[model samples]
Target: MSDQVDVVVIGSGINGLVAAAELAKAGWSVALLERNDLLGGFIATEERTLPGYLHDTYSSWHPLFVSGPAYAALGEDLHRHGLEYRNTDYLVTASVADDGRTTLAYRDPERTAGLFADSRDGEAYLAAVNGFLKIAEPFGALLGSELRSPSTILKGLKLARAAGIGLLRDTVTSGRAYCRREFHGDEVDHLWSPWLLHAGLSPDHAAGGLMIPVLAATMHGFGLPVVAGGSTGLIEAFGKLFAELGVQVHTGTHVERVVVEGGRAVGVVAAGRRIKARRAVLASCTPTALVRDLLPRDAVEARFAERAERFRYGRAAMQIHVALSEPPAWSDALLGRIPLIHLSDGSGSTGIACAQAEAGLLPAKPTVVVGQQHVLDPSRVPRGAAALWLQLQEVPFAPAGDAAGELDTSNGWTRELADAYATRVLDRVAAHAPGLAATIRAVDVVTPVDLAAHNVNAVHGDPYGGAGELDQSFLWRPGPRGTVPGLWHIGASTHPGPGLGGASGHLVAQRLLG
Candidate 1:
């Protein structure tokens, strides 16, 4: 292979794949380099527990990707390359409390609202969602474009004129506060509050109020989708598209540094070889890594480097995959049919767990995201067997103590600690599903340490890139461009934050193409 290309992408994550594929399709020679032996960064499917059980090791849902502009641009190509998705037409998600009370959401917002006990709250819920949809176009434009660009400024102005100052106020309000002010009942709060964790925010965070509506409208519109067979099918499709486009893919090759000359990133040194980039070098990595390790000391100003240094990571996360002899017999039958369910009671419980995690203590009752891929695609498991993708969002990356006061954390995520925590999580699940423990054939626990080891972008076990807090998000996000002319950034750390959505990569690719 030639030691040069039009672009050198320094990671094979979803963002990197999207950028490389888009550019290559536009007739640019792109060389994608990855430090790992695999192409997909966090996107992987494997049978961690037992044979014949395919589990999405990390991120499993694709609602963000399916609804984003990246899919609009590449969905056809990916589908043609053997990508298939399975989605629920009705029941999308639900949340269950410890007392067996359940709140559900469906593809029809009106139907979901109708299920609420207080009729006034139901009306308020519908109104909030409808209000968001009116501004969704302009809001989406700003999110999918460069925040400081002229187009983004115009979009912001359009949104302001359309919604007035209320939009700004809602953007800064906490989800907990929004729920309290808008709805009288706890149903709305129960259903959407725990979702803030998925955006790397606590219920009390500034942007949760806005994010709650976004999540609600997104799920109601797109429904929850999981790639057929396994999440890796999406990656496999991307690989096929890359091959057909003649994009050079170099896995197991570490990019040591960006070779900058005359204040431009001309190439990258990967595995002791110089691979030149004639157009651009897109580093789908954390800002911290880009400033502190990848680029030369003088490549960027000291202030920018310091800002990167201060890029904070949110709470850690853990994944527990369970292979069951039979499906979990949830006490509430509705939960059994739902694709994903949250074991949270909205802001009341979720807030406390977030606080515990932030204090460096393992949440006693962490929010458990129960993902049942087998329900949507039976091919994931054997004939009658099932699997559970249990995700723990409120976890301490380096626990100082256990909130339950039952596990020792002095050694930091030791196997014993992880196992104990896993038991705690399973016990919580068992409370709702009495027969859960008996049906578990095997369980595999992935700690925060494991997550950090698997993906470099998962800095300190923060899977959603860096913290999605107000200060480091939106216009303040790191970059699609640096001081260096040809250097660019994408991935979870960049604007539009983290998700399966390839927005950041698509945005940067469009800019380069333009």
Candidate 2:
């Protein structure tokens, strides 16, 4: 196994697979390694309770598919490999009250505004949609995009100008406080903050608050689309493309360490076997995981070590997947047909998300984002049934008071916590779909522990490798002057930051070959 090759890529996550496929397509002999039976890190699928039902493990929606001249270079590869997308129109924002669920935002933003037009503030909140888009339109143009310098702002500006008047000015100020001030009810704030989280922003945070308008603006332009199969299908599709291109993909094998000589990565030792590479070794993981664990600690910089020790990473969510006997009955016919619905509970959904990530405790009400993928593609569930996913933000990863954020999943009550959260989510679903609780033929739970156990790449179930902070992006990521020549990274944890778009993978490929 220590034989020479062009490149050795550790981890079979989407970015790693895509990078490997691109390298192989470019005529380089590449080998992709994974520790689990599955190939995707967050992109895998499962059928936990029942035999036939399929559930997306992590990501189910991707509207901002990476497309541009950079991706266009792949040519027929994209279409031929079954990489397809479909859109839907459904946004459900509810306010849980003693009376009943007051759906703040139902059909579209206009319809939602109409619901909010009771007072002057409410009417203003509703009417602000158009004015909000004034800013959102330009931000959408940069989705999963490459950063441009001041000289290149014209490219982005040209796209915004194409959107029409007023949109650019809206971009100048994100309507966080504006929406809060205008909307008389907290429901309106709940309605918009989830959109901000979709953009990798925290709802309560300032810079993050601006993301709501941007998310709404992006979705307003491009519909939220789910792939027909499961999220794993995306990874499998990439793997199939790799197979056709003759890339070597080996699963269930984890690389123990990188064989570095004179500060240059030359090979890898995995499963007690050594495999040498001729050109480079790329890690589809966080820099801390790669350098501290795999390389000689003496070679790493003191600053990187210090940052790794203190950088915050409290984000961890548990997913509850249920296969129901019948589709949950929602009073809103529109929500039943939409692909994604956000359940705010009581507190601002975005606030709970950010707070839990910092405090590391379950939010009292627990903000959740629920997805019924079957709404868009019925094939995920069995005939005459629905596949549902409930994601909660409050599940703790490691013990809160631990010296460094270390999560020991070996504990007992973690599952108890997951069970409690899962029941509440299921109850919420039961309200929407009567008899859903009784019809739970099969139920599967993915704890932060299970996720990390599956692949250390996810590091405590933080599927997102690094903090998706504004400061730690673009060339500043892993610091572009190449940590080591012939070495690179492109994944959820990398620049252009997380989620379905293949921007980072495409960038890494272009960076190496371009």
Candidate 3:
């Protein structure tokens, strides 16, 4: 590899890959470096549970990615390079109460409305969907644009013109408040409230009211989709495209520090070698890492450094992957067909779990996101076999105690504790799926501590980068511009928050190229 390049990307997460691809497409020489031997930061698949069963260990869904700007620009090239996505048909998603009742959302809006018990709520549901569709254009633009940019102001003006000033106040309302004001049924609230968890927020969180409608419209517009083969399929395709673009790819190399001289990031020191950057140095890292550990002490002003120091991270999360003998048989048949179902009971259950996690206590009943990959893509496992992807979003990074007082907290996420917690999660699933316990061929549990150890960007096991609170988002995002010149930030920690969407990467590339 050359001693210098036009850009040096410090991480190989989705954002890093997207930024590198876009910059290289614009004819800028780029070098992408990763500490882990793997390329994707949180996207990976493996037979951890049992051989021949491919489980998406981290993030699996791609509705955001397929619908975002990055895909609009690079989808053709990525698809041409062997990135195939498999999606469900009618059943998009659902929520199952503890009593075995289900609330489902279908691709057809009318069909979804039919699931509602009350006729009035059904009509209200349709109206909400229509209202969201009316404003989705401007709202999406605002979410995807740089908050400090003039285009953002124009988008806001367009939204205000379309929806009126009242909508602006609605944007700041909590999710719980939005549900109460819009609909009068528990069914609708139960169905959509759990989705806020994906954004690293609870039902009581600020800006959740704004997210609820968008989340509903997104699911109704684009159903949950996964890679054709496995999560690794998309990353492998990215690797192939990166190779073709002649971007130097370095894996398993630790970047000790970003070299700063004369108040600008000129290069990065990795493995005791200095790789210079002529144009820019992009760090797809948490603010904690970039400001505190990587940059020189005098590179950033003290006030900015203090703000970075106080950058808060949300609660921890864990993953429980199960290889099943056969597909789970749910009491409600609708749940059997849905690709993703929340075993959250309802919004009340979800709220309690989030509260418990934030308080440093292990929730007795965590909202279990039960993902059935085989329902859409059967090739991931053996014939007639199934794989369950369970995401536990409500858990502490460092446990203080268990709310149920059943597990040991003194050890701090040891293997025994993880296994015990995994058992509790399985019990929750078995409540809805009668044969789930019997069908389990193997189980693999990953605790929040395990997650933090896996990726440094996942500070304290916050998988969405950092908390998606209002303060850390929008114009307040740490970068695309940093305190130090020639430095930029892109990743889940920055604008537009988490998920598989490459919006941060796409946005940063546009700015650099301009």
Q: Give the total clashing residue pairs for model 3.
A: 0
Note the residue pairs that clash in candidate 1: none
* lDDT per model vs. reference: 0.92, 0.63, 0.88
Decreasing TM-score order of the candidates: 1, 3, 2
lDDT per residue (tens digit) for residues 213-249 in model 2: 5455455555666666776656756767887887777
- Give the clashing pairs for model 3: none
**Residue-wise lDDT of candidate 3 within 302-338, one digit each (tens)?**
9889988999999999999999999898888778788
Off by over 4 Å in 2: 66-78, 89-178, 181-188, 345-357, 399-414, 432-434, 469-482
Error of 1 at 217 (Å): 0.2
TM-score of each: 0.99, 0.82, 0.98
Q: Which RMSD does model 3 reach against the true structure?
A: 1.2
